[model samples]
Each structure stands twice: as structure tokens, then as C-alpha cells.
Target: MNFGTLYRKSAFTDNPKGGNPAGVWVGETLPSGDVMQRIAAEVGYSETAFMAPTTGYYRTVRYYSPEMEVTFCGHATIAAGIVLGETEGDGKYQLTTAAGEVSVIVQNEGGVREAALTSVEPKYTGASDVLINEVLSALGWQPSDLDGSIPPARAYAGAWHLVLAVNDQNRLAKLNYDFERLKTIMLREGLTTLQLVWRESADVFHSRNPFPVGGVVEDPATGAAAAALGGYLREAELITVPATILIRQGEAMGRPSRLTVEIPATGGIVVKGTAVPIETE
Candidate 1:
């Protein structure tokens, strides 16, 4: 059972029970893919982050779900950042991931310590009609259920997500989907999660992410999806530039998580949140 320095932390919330729980393993050297996958599965979290020191202020990090290795994971990154800050010191750290280079800034604000991760260059593309129809069908939704303001698209920051905005918040709340069918379509399309959301205002939104592909029902706080949404809005010209928006998630699942997203005029998107250590026996 000995792997390395394993820490359990919840990301995107200061309370241990509010945010998404992620396993963070810090070691002198990264473990094999199979070992990492096993450890992640044993941890039984949505995603577990394995990181090892490489050089000054740089770490080699990889993410794994219970099912497979993920290209990148934002909440786990946030958890790892807090772990590093608590173990080392509060500062900036560069992470080398399969997706690309990501930088995290850890700081103490007021009485709480928080981490903000700047995602890799983000991009988005229109989703094919066939893909949209299949996904909607799997969710038992019609094309009329979608918000005309923001069209469906695949957005990527470190990982790819299918973004679908609904005009009604009720639709986002009652999230019932066919897990096997949706997982098939998502895996076929190489998607990480479905970013089902409802925009409340210009700077406020509600989101729910189905992560059947990750062997989880849903994600309480999806930093990758939130970062992707910020990028998508900026790139799609749906939101004004240099805006900071608040995303409220996980309420439906009873684990409320808040994600703060900062969108600049250009470059990578920034997602900020605080993580608290989770004590397990």
C-alpha cells in the first residue's frame, strides 16, 4: 500500500466536504503508469494526481482516473498545488503534463491558502450535428432544450469537454443520463466531461459535469471544464474580455463547489480556488 507521500485534499472549496476530492501523491520519482492507475483506483476519487520533483519550481505531473490516465486534470492540479505549498512554500510552480505546460500560483489570501492555475492555450471547435444529437439523445434532451445564445461546441484547455448551455436552470439541476451510452459517445469523441451549464448572468453561472468516461457519475468541481468554459466564452465572443466570473457547481450533488474563472483578452485562462485537507481514517 506504500506508494509515496499521499495526501487527500478537496479542491475548489475551503471546506473539506464541499469541493471535489482528489488524491495527490508526491514522490522523488514518478511511478509507472500501471502503478499510478492502481493507486488512483484504490484512492477512489474522481481523479488522482501523481507528481514528482524534476527541477527548481518544476514538477512532472500526471493524472489518472479509476478507468485510465487522463491528459490533464485541473482540480487535482489545484489540490497538488496546495499540497506543494503546504509541504514546500507558497509560490509559483510549473507543471509538465501530457497536455502542455501549466503554471500554478499558490498564495495565502486573508486566513486561507488558495491556488490559481493558468491553463495551457485554450481552443474550441463546433460540435458536429451527429455528435450533438447523439449526446442529447443519451441525456434524454432535445435540440430545443439548448440555449441558442451559446451553441454546442467542444472546448479544450488541458482536456476536451463538450459544452452545452441550457436556458433553464432546472434542466441543469435534474441531471439524469444514460451512463453507458453517454460514455460510449464521449469516449468515441475523446471528451473528458460534458459541461452542462446555465448562465445566470454576465458573470455568474451554474454548471454540472457528467464524467462517466472517468468512471464517475459527476464531478463536484471541474476546474478543467470551468477553464474551458471561460476560454469558450472569450473565443466565441459571448463574454467580454478581462472578466472574472464565478461558477457555482456541485449543489445538486450536495457538495457545493465554487470556481473562480478569470478570462483575459488573450493567452491561457486562469481558474482560482481554495483546497482544504481531508482527513481519512
Candidate 2:
């Protein structure tokens, strides 16, 4: 199928070698859904962002994984923002996604480009004991493996994620779960991912996301989950308002990624990261 300019970018890392790779397709008009899905499957990334220019500074954006279209994707959005900056100059661009209207800011800092996205208003719900137990069993984790301080919850910014905080960093490191089992549970619960985390400090966290729904075994840096986490913390009154937290992910997978999250006293969460072009054949 014929297409417009396509760029391969690695988001959340200044270095192309260290972040999650995503395909960014910029076109005057979006292709058909089937075509987009085919291209996304061919690109074989966690997600591919398709952007089409609209009236004024606004753009219509859609995210597709290898398997299906997702409501929103953070890393791909960052990559798309950087691409838009390079093409249209750096500034805030309005994006219309399935979730809602979102704003992304792209700017060059210290000769490196970075993008920050403001998520939709966050909301969350407590995870039922039965659901939590089912997930833990699928993950082969026992009740003692959890951090009693941070209770399990289902959080949403642009998508739904199961927030599970473990007690130790070591437990977080050894991530081995039954993919099909977890996938079944996630599908049944309408979960996009399992946000597995270990709190290193008050402002620092280590995360690992199992994205069986997206046809990805693990996501290196999950922007949606990160935003959801910020919302969950605020809703639970676990962190101070106007907090800036750092999330380190994809480390164990060898593609270390960093996401900076800004949690305000109220309203949407802000997540920032950098994206660099990746050379592809």
C-alpha cells in the first residue's frame, strides 16, 4: 500500500539504542484501518502512531499495535511529537485521540529534542480481592510478594492498567508470568497492561509492564501506565501534590527507558520523554 513519510523513532531515550522503538507515520490523510493495521504489523513495534494534519495546529492521531488499535500510546505519541516538531517547529500541538483531546509539547533542549504529553483526567478504582488474587496467581506471585502500603488498583488515564506494587526490587526484577494466563485475565477485565512496580524511593520507581493485550510480552516504557500511576498516587494521597516522579523501566530488558511524570494538585498527569530517529532499511 502507498503511504506518506514514515519514520522509525525510539522514544523515552535520548540515545536511540536505549529506548522503546516505535513507528511514526505522518501523512496528509490517514490510511484505511486495514492498511494501518497491516503497516503496524509489519513495523513490529509495540505501537505505531499515525498522524494526519488537520485544521490549524490540531492533528488527528491514532495508535495501532501489531494486533489491534489502541485508544492511546505514550511512547508513540512522543515520537510523533518530535516528528511534528521537526516538520512544523517546536511548540504545543493539539491531538485528538480516541480517549480525548490531549496536548503535546515538543522542544529542543541542550541540542536534544524531547516531548511532553498531558494526559486526560485520571480516574481509578480499587481492585477487588478476587481479581488481585487471580492476577497474582497468573504471575506466580504470592500475597507476601506485594507491598501492603500500596494496594492494588485499576487506574486509567487514557487506558486501563492494573497497578501492582511489589515489596522488593528483586521481586520486580524477576518477571516471569504465564503469558496466556495473564492475557486471558487481562482481556476478561478489560486491562491494557499490568503495571508491575517497585518503589525505590518517594519520587523514584522501577516499573515493568506486561502488555499481553497489545501482543507484546513487555513494554519498555509505558506512558499510559505511567500517567495512570500518577493518578493512582494522587487519588490514594500517597504522594505530595505537584510532585515530580521518575520512572525507570526496560532496564532488565536491556533497553533502559526513563519517564518523567508531573503530578499536579489536580487535573491531568504530564509525562515527558525524548525520542530519536532510528535508521531502518
Candidate 3:
């Protein structure tokens, strides 16, 4: 069957070239898992979002990659929101996802239409060095490459991630890994992506994500990971409560994404970004 209309938007960055680009499929109904996976692989974006309206104002959504389906995706959600703002009008849209019902606030400001998605309840747990070692081995990185401040954690918002902070920027850039091995470990651990980060400044972070489990090598911008990082910072008491942090990602791959994360003492996190439509020939 011919696929429905699709929109390509780069989430997190205002410009089309920047941010994590996502393919959004909007229609009365989404395709089957196999079809969606095939389409996602054909689209070649890290993640593609599919949406169908629910009973009320809420919409049911799902995310797919070249290989499989994921519980949730932050960048794709943002991209869907921007599409809604233009097509469905600017306002709040409630989405029913596999994870939970998430609310997106859509608004157009200064010619930029953006969406801020409130995540599901975020939580973090301490990870053992043994588990971290498995990931390090697959990534061909040493334990010393990590920054000792945050420690390693299995963080979750809408999806699960391993948050690894590298001490040196160079370590973050040289991302060569055994994809199959990492995918096996991540699947066993029930992880969606491995969040690799380097702090560029006090409030700014440069990040990368290895998403082998999802059939993608890396994610330029990860909203779910950003929310998980905010939760980790709060749970570990690494940052001040009720703080706002900026995450810069995808620069290594030349697709820059900027995610704004808001952390409160206790609550679900808010990940904000803009999605611009990318014309396809």
C-alpha cells in the first residue's frame, strides 16, 4: 500500500539542518509494525513517529526505527507537535503513547512554531560498574573515559537510557563500536540508547546517543535522554533543583540539535524544542 503523507522536521533546533530530524506519519490510522519498520528504514531517519487520533482530543502515537518499535521518542514527539501546530492549529494536544499520555504545548512565536512535551514520570537508578563495563567494552572505551561526577545510571522517562558522561570531548567524538554486540547488551538490559555526553560549559552539554537496539547507530538529538539526564542530575543531587539546562547534540554529525530541559525538585521533566518541516523531493 502507498504510505500516507509524511513530514520531515528537525526537532530541538529551529533551523531545518540542525536538530535531530524525524519523519512523521499522520493519518487516520498507522501502518503495521513490519510496514512501519520498513518505511522507517527507507526513510533512514533515526526515528519516525506515527500518529492516529484517539477517542477524544488525545491522539495515539508510536515510534519506529529501521528495525523495531520503541515505547517513546522525544524528538519525534516534538516534530509531531510542530506539524499539529500548523495543521491542527496552535494549542495543547494530549497524546496517548505506549508509555503513557503525554501533553504537548504548541505555540508559534516570532515565526517559529515549537512544541514542549512533558515527559512521563521520570526515574533513575544506580548502575553497577559491571554493567557499565559491558557497555564500555562494546564501545571500545575505557572506564576512565567517563566523568566521575554523575556516575553511570540507567535513567528513564518515556524510554530507558544509559547515561555516560565522558571526561574528554575527544572520547565522545571517536564513536566506534561493535553494533551487534552493543545491541545485544542493550536489548538484554532493556535500554533504548546509550547517552554519551561532554560538558562544554557550566550549563551547556554536548551529547551523543548510540541507539543500536533501535537499529540506528547514533541519535543526534535525544529528548528522552535529555529528560533522563535531568532526572539523573536531580536524583544524584548533581545539579541544583529547579534548574534549566541546555543540551547541544548532533554537532559531530553536523546536524546540531538543542534541547532545553527543565528540572524541578520533584515532578515530570519538560523537554522543549522546535521542529521545522524538511522538504522532500
How does candidate 3 score on lDDT? 0.88
The candidate that achieves the highest TM-score relative to the unseen native structure: 1
Candidate 3 TM-score versus the reference: 0.94
lDDT of 1 at 104: 97
- Which order, best to worst by TM-score? 1, 2, 3
Better of 1 and 2 by TM-score: 1
Residues 1-281, candidate 3: write the lDDT tens digits: 54477889889887788888899888777788888888888998989998885123578899997788999999999999988888888899999888998999999889888799998989889888889999999999999899998688999999999999999999998999999999999999999999899987767888999998877888989999999999888878899888999998999889888899998889788999998778777
| Segments in model 1 whose C-alpha atoms lie over 4 Å from true places | 1-3
Residue range with the least summed lDDT across 10 consecutive positions in model 2: 50-59
Across residues 1-281, which tens digit of lDDT does each residue of candidate 1 receive?
A: 43488999999988888999999998888999999999999999999999986335899999999999999999999999998888888999999999999999999989788999999999999999999999999999989999999999999999999999998988888889999999999999999999999999989999999999989999999999999999999999999899999999999998999999999999999999988989998
TM-score (C-alpha) between model 2 and the true structure: 0.97
Q: CA lDDT of each candidate? A: 0.94, 0.93, 0.88
3-23 in candidate 2: lDDT tens per residue?
A: 578899999998878888999
Q: Rank the candidates by lDDT, best first.
A: 1, 2, 3
